[model samples]
Structures are given as structure tokens and as C-alpha cells.
Target: MIEKIEDIKRIELSQFKFPVNVYLIDDLLIDTGFPRTAKKLLSYLKNKKINKIVNTHGHMDHTGGNSLLQGYFRCRIYHYPAKRSYTVVEKLLFGNLKNFTSETPPEKINTDNYSFEILYTPGHSDDHITLFEKKKRYIFSGDLVLHGEAREVSRDVKIYRAIESLKKLRTLRPEKIFPGHGEIFYGYEVLDEKIGYLEDLGERILRLYEGGKSVKEIVKIVFGGERFPYFFIKGYFSCENLVRSYIKDPKSL
Candidate 1:
């Protein structure tokens, strides 16, 4: 349930697909696990002295347990300070997501002894933010930097914005990445790798678009051949959504 990464602790339920990656470093709590793992998360938080809850983004899984945690700890919460809205496709696939809000945090999040800089990194979602610790070169990146290539995170994600966010993160030259889904990355060129992934995907999108392929056709040509969860649907969780995102922000090309 809880694992050690130096002084920070990672709490995950490990029950279903892509569980939330919540981290506790000193007095800061970055992202909360889903509702299914709330009990375990509460157990871990009960013994700790957390003063602030900083959410990397407003995704449901990352913020599901916020009310419960806030009810228990009654600490200040931080996020990208944006209103929430759902796309027609997302509503059809996963209905009724809650809106989350938090005051824009100050430049420096000064805890008892440690501090971090809050960065607004939008792409996967509009309200995404990444926390960077300057002294240690550590970044708490939410879904902004997942393990692999970015695609169809939601129908609303912006491919260009994601690329821009990655570029901004790469500027920080972080030594380690604490992501939202997978294990922690240590001493690796994590940001550059993600940037390269998006660059390559953008190239593929442009090549397909130049060939006069529709978004649906592009999806099929790019990722439709891979079989796993049937991806025939047009709007909901299909590569077509990714194609549309790339089309909107083709500057990445």
C-alpha cells in the first residue's frame, strides 16, 4: 500500500487499471488516490503530519478522495485554479465528473523546512500543474507525464498543449520524475523521451493528414491495427480523438 522513495512515500491501491499515484513528501501531499483506495490512504495519512494537499490536476481518480482527505486533515488544497467542464464524448463514455477547484498557490510552497515551485503544465487536461523541487531536482508530474506515448487520455486533451508542457518541463532538467500512474523514474532523461514521443506522433499525424485521410481513417492507419479493447467507436476513447487533438495543435509538427 505504501512504499518508500527516500523521505517521500507512495500510496497506491493496486486493484484495477492504472491506479492513481499519490505521493507524500514531508508536509506536502501531491494527488490523492481514487475512492476505492481512500481507506488505505486515510490510514497512511492518519499518522502523518500533512499541512497541504496539492493536486497535480483535476482528474477524477486523482481527486476522488479529496473531500474525505480534506474532511480528515482540514488542510489547504492547491490546483491550477480553473473551472471544470466535460466533453460530449467523455460524458458519453464516463458520465458526470465532478468539478474541482483550489486557489492558485503562491510561487513557493514553503513547508516546515522544504519548499517547491508550482508549475502550470496543461495538455492532458487544462488545469494540470507540476511541482518542482529546485534543490533536489524532483518533479511531481501528474498525468502530464505518463509512462508511454500520450494518446486519448480524454477527448479534451490538447496534443500541442501537451507538447508545450513537455517542453516547459524539459527546461527544468529534472533528475527524477514522480508520475501519476507508474513507478518513479530516477536519473533518466525522462522529459526528453516524452518530448520525442510527442514529436514523432505529430509527424505521423501530419503524414496521415497530408495523405488526405480523415481523422477516423488516421486512427485506423496509426493505431487501429493494434487489437486489445475494440476501438471501433468514433468519439469515445478512440485514436480518432487523438487525431483531432493533433489537428487542433499541429504546431508540434
Candidate 2:
């Protein structure tokens, strides 16, 4: 599905129940959804001009099509450097990130009329970023702000950083958030919802810790324990990760 929000073209490249969106503005593409969906994305943009590609981060779901799309268009690919290497499971599931040539994306990218400011807002991942169109008050939040509460974070996620990033964006007061997953959200309701949930969750976690609840017990009580597919990821993505982050940095909120 393709929807136009003023000058931006949002392409739902992933057919998953929870989709990943790739935004296109003029010759620049915000993200490339997945490796398997590259052909589909390519066919969709066969005639469209693509001279540059900017990935919000190095995650496979976001950068999977990088090699193919860049090979095809010979466009320069820009992204923030990955803070860490991909996990074994990540490599198995979505392949490794390669062909990203630029570590520093321009602070601002300009099209014929619109301008987007690249904001380094990590937490979801150390390299995660959001694209902000200041005049329009629109934020292309790349996994920095999801639709619901952030209960279980992946192993690499820094809960403290995530909270700080949320606080930063909250100050921006975005009117609309084009998230990496889920539908576009209007106003600050969803953003505030996530921030509130995470903050409350952290306090609850701290209290539980003070009560002498072990991380395992805390996970069970707070998040029902890591379940199903989370276990399949070899604890790389789990509730324990979230608990650990806060336990390690209680003063960071």
C-alpha cells in the first residue's frame, strides 16, 4: 500500500501483520524494508528516480534491500555507523548489513521544497535515528517510537537511552509520527503514551528490584516472561534485556 502524506510517499514494503514502511521524497528513500521484499520494492519504484538512500539504522529489516537497491540504482547509501555487530540469529534471519558507504548523513536533506533534519535518537538501537520535518512537525520515527508500550527490548537496546530519546522528541512535540512499524499516528498522544509507559515501567522495575525480586522473577511479574519467538531468538530479544538495562542504569531516567 502506498499513501502520500503531502510530499512524502510511504510504501509498505513488508507484508507482515505489522508492516515496515519505507518513505520516499523525491530522489531520496528513507529506508529499504527487507532483502526478500527488495524486488517488490524495486518493481514499485522502477520508474521513480532514486539517486540516494538513507537508512535510519543498520537493522536488517530496515537495510535488507540496501545491496540490491544500491546495486541497481548505483545510488549512494548513507547511515549512522552500527554501534555493534549483528547477532548470529540476526545474520541467519535477515543476512548481514553490507554496501552502506556513508556513516555521516547530511544534517539536513532538501528536496525541491521540503527539508528534513536527521536527528540521532538512539535507544531502540544505538544507531537509530529519526527524520524531522520541522516546518510540518512530522517525525519519521524509526523504531524510536512504536505504537504501544515498550515492554520487552532486544539485547542491544539501552532503556536509558530510549527514555532520553523519547524525552528529546517530546520536546519537539511532533504533530505526526511516521513510525518504522504500525500506521501513522497524529499528535503527541502515542508518543506520550510510550514515554509514560516506559517511565512507569522503570519505576515499577526499580521497586521490584528493591523488594529483592530477581531479574527472572521480575520478568515473570512484569512481562509474563520471555515467550515463544523471543526464546527462539536465543535471548537476544527478551524481557530480561529490558530489566537488565534499567538495573544497570537506574539513575539515567
Candidate 3:
């Protein structure tokens, strides 16, 4: 059991323990999994009827199955209007580096079966979006919100945007949050946790900056301990970038 939520179907694929949830409702398939898992997904939907496939964002993991799924089902793909250019960049990067090419430019969603209100939450990525169902009070938060461990917003622009988006989401008072990379959260506590984590990190970075510590020095002091993974060195550098960016605009902290 990969922790299935109401009104959503869960499918575990490969080594990724966090299974992808496909929201099935009246012929709509929201957010397909990575390309490597397409075969299993196709098998799952073989006899089932589907109308359209919509993505909460344009991350490769989210839209990697697009081309393959379209080849079989020939269904229309829908996503937020903001992800178009990012989708193109993703296609270009994957196209040049990988043998498989499964990228499809999605269309803007405008339907009646399910009404969606979009929140431009750009922290995990510049083009991130969360979809809210007004009637159900359910949010398909791609990466803006997560259930476990805080996410890094590498860029200052994205961090500011994420804060704005989170503030906007606070108004919704959503009952449940279906995130892209984790288990669904039951209440608004998850939102507060995310905010608190970011705020703490921001404050620490600001204090280190005020103490005249170089980014590398701060990285060693703050996260160079054994608690942090060795592989996260690059991520630490990204966080340094965030720190530098925040230095330029202290309001972000």
C-alpha cells in the first residue's frame, strides 16, 4: 500500500517508493509518471477509457510518460499556461542527453467536468503550479507543498514566488493536499511546517551572512556535519546561491 488517498489511484513503479497517484474522474487522467514506468501505466489503463491527461507541472518525472501515453491513448494533455517554455527546455535537455524522447507540449485546460483554480507556486521550480478543486477542497500541489522533508528553492526569485504562492494558498483552507513527491497531508499543518522550515533556513543564512562568513564557510558550519549527505554538496552550493540572492534582497528572508 503506497498510501492511497480518496478519489485517487496509486501505482508504485520502480525503486521510487513514493508511488504516483493518478486522479481518475470521468475520463480525466491527471499527471502521468516517468517514462520508464509508462509500460506499467499503459497496462493499467489498457481497458480503461480516458479522455485527457493533465499535469500539475512540467517536471520530467511528471511529464516523461506524455509522449508514450499519447501514442497509445492519443489523449489531449493539459497543464498550466506558465509551463510551456519550461517544457520546451526540458525536451531540449532530455532530447540531447537521453536516447528516449517522450515530450509533448500540453494545452491549457478549459473544461467543465472538473473545475480547477490555479496557484502559481514557483519554488521547487519556476513554473510550478498547484491545482485546487473548489468543490472538493483538494489541492494537487505539484511541488510547492511536500509531506516529508523540506524542499530547496534554489533561486531567490523562486523563493519569493514560493512565499507569495504559499500566502495565496493559505486563503484556500484546503482539507487535503496531494503533492507530487510524497504522501498526502491531512490538514494545513503541512503548510505551516514548510513555512517554518524555510523561515529557519533563511534566518540561519542571514545570520551567517551578517557574521561575515563566506558561503563555503557557512556551508561547512551549518550543513557539513555527518547529518548531511555527501551527495548534497551540490545542493549546498545551490542553497549558497539562494543565500547570496537573498543578501541582495533582504526582504526575501
Candidate 4:
């Protein structure tokens, strides 16, 4: 079932535990959830008149429902023109390969509604973009700013970019945030928190590197104490990427 939060509605789909938020403005649907959850989403949309569809970004979990939604609504899908190819490859790699297939490049998305501006905040991925809706004072931040425990598991270049992106977002002064993977936050405080976390991690890794620590050693030190083994690999990967980023440019911290 989809829970309505003010003007936005969200549906938690499947056991994948994917949280797909569907923002609505009367007849317009801002985003569609994962493709594997298309049937349920379609059923929910059957009663509404959906004329426009846009994605926050092009990750598989976010764009997975695009093809089926396009077939059902027969409407143009809008996404950042600059990020289309990257989004496509990302979906192909992580989406349910057997069930969801790719589509042609997405057409350019341009709108006159000055209510929101697309901020190119690449960190999580080079194609990442954040939608700042001034009217609502909310930002539809796609994986660039995560709530709860923050993770920095991307290419070193991307991690640096992500930090830069977060800095850019801090300037927006958004009152709230709707992220891709977690609960909505009340204010920009979360952004500051994430930035601090990344900065601190970067500094720690730099210190370890100065002490002749390898990525493997640092990963163990940073995350070996965590109780959940599930996070070991991801934490290690993130540390490795940070280490690489630090090596490339010590000033990134």
C-alpha cells in the first residue's frame, strides 16, 4: 500500500525492501518505483490520471519500473539528459536482468515550472542530480545524501564529486529532504551530518595511509568492529575508494 506524505505518496515494494516514493501533483507522477514492482504500482495508478513522469535519477531501483510504466501510460519519460547513458548501464547491471529490459535513450527533460531546479550533484554517480522544489522547500535527493548510516562506496573521483555535491546542496538551504533509499529528513542538518561523516572518514583514512596502511588494513580498522558481517565488504569497498581518492588529491579532505 502507498502511504501519503503531504503531497507525496510512497509505496514500499517487495521483500527487496525497496522504498519507492511516488510524488504526485494531481495528474502528474514525478517518479515510478522499481520495475519488478510495476504490477502493483500500475494497479495503484489505475484510478489516477497520470500525464507526466520524471525520475530523480537513473539507478535500477529507481528506474526499473520505467518500461512497464511507459507501456501502460504511453507518456514521455523525463530524466536528466546528461545522465541517460550512465543511468542505463547502472540499471542493466543491477536490475532484475531476466525481467526488466532496457529502452532507448531517454529524451531530454525540460520544464517551465520554475518551482524546482535540477542541481547536478554528482558524487554517488557522475550522473546524479538533485531536484530542489522551492515551493515545497524540499529536495528530491537521489542517493547523493543518505539518511541514517552514510556510505561512500563509489569511484574515488565520484566520492570527491559527491563531497562537492553535498557542499553545493548545503548552499540550497533546503528545509527538508526526500532521499532515494531512506526516510525523509526534517532539515539540512542531515546534509551537514553526512558531510561531516565523510570528511571525518577521509581524514582518518589519510592518517592511516600516512602510517603505511593498505586499503585492506584500513578497511578492517574502520569496519572490523561492526557487528554485522553484511556490511564488511561494502565498508571495505568504500574505504578503498576513499583511500584512492585521497591519494589522487590530498586536498579532497
Candidate 5:
């Protein structure tokens, strides 16, 4: 379904366990939901003009429909340029990226009414970015801001970097957030909650590490035990990955 917010239109493509959202502003489309849901996305924008595409990140859920949309609209796509390759498991989960090559977007994106500052907010992933319209204080926070606490993270997630990105967003004090997943939320309370949780978690992990507690012991003590879904994801998202993040980048603590 499509919901209008001012001049922007939000297309909610997936409503599963992890919901996916894509936004449209003027001729620009921010983040494609998934390759499987590309048809629905196309249907919503059938009567609209989408000349440009900008992705918040390269994750499958976010960029799955890139190839299809670009081919259909013959539009240019933009993303933060990175030099990393995906793992076999990552490809299996996030889907193939096809031959889509995105140029680097400018510091600001100017549409008919609003001009968005492309903030390089990399926490969820190194190539992650968030679009901000300073005048309206609106943020298109990809995976950087979610509704719930991020207890488990994937292998590529740098918790310290995520914390820093959250802090950066907090400084903006955005009035409303158009997230990559979930609903359009108001205020910075969710950002605060995530920052506080990560900071506290980092401190605790640092303390446990200083006390010679192994990652295994830390995960057990902090999270109690591995819950469902972690085993199924091949340990891609786990408390242990969160614990190791501090070890990898302890200076942040």
C-alpha cells in the first residue's frame, strides 16, 4: 500500500517479520523493496515518474529490485561506493545484485520542493547512508534506526560504528523518520533508546572482556542463551557477533 506524507509517498512492500519500505519523492525513488516485490512496487508508481533511484544500502532487501526498476524505467541509481564482496551465504539470503552499478550521489539531492542531504551514516553496513531534509527535519534512516532494540547483528555490522552513526542522527534531532523497515515514526525517542542500549551493551562487554570473560561466556551471561532463528540463520545474527564487535573495535568504548 502507498501512504502520502507531504510530497513524498511511502510504498510498504513487505509486511513479514522484517518489514520493508521504499519512499518516493518527486522523480526519485529511495530504496527498492525486493526483486520478488518489484511488480507491486511498479504498480504503485505506474502513474508516477521515477527518473532516479537512490539506495540507502546494498542489502538484498533494500536493493533487490534495482535491476528490474532500472531496466524498466531506464533510470540512474546511486549508492555509496564500496569495495567489498558478498559471501555465499549473503548472496543466498540477500539475492544476486545482477549487474547494477550505482554512481555516488551528490552531498545533497534537490527535488521540486525539498533538498535532501545525503548523510553517510554507516552502522548497519559500511556503505549505508541516510537522507535528511534539514528544513523539515525528516530522515530516511535505512537500517540505522529500527523500532526495537538491536540485540543481534550480522557479521558485517560494526556495533561501534553503528553507535557513532546513531549519535550523529541524534544530533540532528529529526522530527520524523522514514525508515527502511517498519512505519514512519515521529520524534527521536527510538534513536535515543537504540543509542543507550548500544552504549550500555558496549560498556558491559568491555567490562566483561577486561575481566577475562570469553565471548562465549559473555554471550551466555548477557543474552542468557541462543534463542530461536539464530540457529536457522547460520549464526549470521547472534549475540556472539554483537560481543565480538566490541572486541574488534574496543577503542570506541
Candidate 6:
């Protein structure tokens, strides 16, 4: 279903195992929907007169439809510089992010009604960036504030960097935040909630470690032994991933 948030339009979907929320701002499309939702994505853009695409990050679910949409509209796909080489990215399972040949995007982009400033907000991914509209204080925050908790994540995500990223966003005072997934709404409160969740996770991990609980035991105690709900990506995101972040820096608490 499509949701109207103030002046922004949101295309929300759930069949892809992970929730998908793609935003449309005039001719600027923010984060293409997943592969499974490409057809619906095209239909949505059919009458909307899309001219450009701005990917929040290089994550598969976020960038999968870039090629499809680009093929349809002959539009340009813009994102941060690829950390991995093109050949290296091609070898990966989903190299769709390499489809972009956009030069380094400008610091600020001017549209018919608003100007967007690209802010590099890493943590979810090294190349992650957010689009901020200064006049109205709106933030197209990628995956930074997915939910009220940073409970599940990829194993390699850094503990301190994620926290710092959210803290940095707080300083911007973004009145509205349009994330890559879930609903679009206000910002500061969610940042506070997710940051607090991460802090609590660290403290609990410290206490559990002192009580002589192993990593696996700590996972069970914290997340009830639950892996991800999907089978194929079962272990990719789980309580163990967050625990690993905590174990990497118990002193961070």
C-alpha cells in the first residue's frame, strides 16, 4: 500500500521477508523497492514522472530494483562511492549496487521546491548516506533508525560507530525522518530509543559476562534463542550479532 506522509509518498511492502519502504519526492525516488516488488514499483512510477534515483545504501534489498527502474525510465542511479572494487563487487552474491556509474554526487541538490543536502551517515553500511532538507528539517534516513531498537543487524557492524552516527543525526534536529523500511514519521524520539537499546544491550552483556555466561547463553537469555524468522538468512541477523558487537567492546558500556 502507498502511504502519504506530509508531502512525501511511501511505498511499503512486506513479502520480501524484510519490510521495504521506498519514498518518492517529486522526480526524486529514494531507495528502489526489492526485487520481489519491482513490478509494483514500476507501476507506481509509471505516472509519477520519476527522473532520478538516490540509494541510501548499497544493501541488496535497497538497491535491487535500481537496474529495473533505470531500464524503464533511463534515469540515473546515484549513491556513495563503492568501497569494494567493481570486479570485487561483481563477485559478490548481489552486485546490483555496481550498476551505478554516477560521479560523486553534490553536497546539496536543488529541486523545484526544496534543496537536499547529502549527509554521510555510516554504521548500517560504510557507504551509507542520508538526504537532509534543511528548510523543512526532513531527513531521508536510510536504515539508521529502523525501529526503536538496534536488536538485529549484520555481524560486522561496529558498536561505537552506529551510536555515534545516531548521535550525530540528533544534532541535526530533523523534524521528519523517512527511513528505508517501516513507517515514516518524526525523528529525535526514535534516535533516543534505539541508542538507549544499544546502551542497555551493552550493560546486559557486561552483567551476563560477569555471571559466567557464554556468548550462546547470553544470546538465549537476551533473545530467547531466536534466529531470524526467515530460513535462508537465518543467522545473518540475530541476537548473536548484537552480542558480538557488545563482546567486541564491553568497556563501551
Query: TM-scores of all models?
Result: 0.87, 0.92, 0.76, 0.78, 0.91, 0.86
Model 3, global lDDT: 0.62
Overall lDDT per candidate, in order of appearance = 0.75, 0.82, 0.62, 0.65, 0.83, 0.75
lDDT of 4 by residue, 139-205 (tens): 8787787765543454424666778899998888889887776667888988889889888877887
lDDT of 5 by residue, 1-253 (tens): 7889887889888724556999999999999987678778887777788888889988878887887888788888998873336667667666666667578989999888888999998878889999999999999999998877666777768888888898999999999999998889899887888888888888988899999999989988988866645454646767788788888854763
After the best TM-score superposition of candidate 5, give how far the Cα of residue 188 lies from its true spot, in angstroms: 2.0
Better of 2 and 3 by lDDT: 2
Kindly report which residue stretches of model 6 are placed more than 4 angstroms away from their true locations once superposed. Answer: 83-103, 229-232, 250-253
On the 0 to 100 scale, the lDDT of residue 146 in model 3 is 61
Pairs that collide, model 4: 35-64, 35-65, 123-162
lDDT pick, better of 4 and 5: 5
How far off is model 6, as Cα RMSD? 3.5
**Best by the lDDT measure:** 5
Model 3 residue 21 CA deviation (Å) reads: 4.2
Model 1 alpha-carbon miss at residue 103, Å: 2.1
- The residue-level lDDT of candidate 2 at 70 comes to 82
Would you list the rank order by TM-score, best first? 2, 5, 1, 6, 4, 3
Query: For model 6, which pairs clash?
Result: none
Badly placed stretches (over 4 Å) of model 1 are 82-101, 225-236, 249-253
Could you tell me which 10 consecutive residues in candidate 3 have the lowest summed lDDT?
93-102
Looking at model 4, which ten-residue stretch has the lowest summed lDDT?
97-106
Instruction: Say which prediction, candidate 1 or candidate 2, comes out ahead on TM-score.
Output: 2
Specify the poorest-scoring 10-residue window by lDDT in model 5.
Answer: 225-234
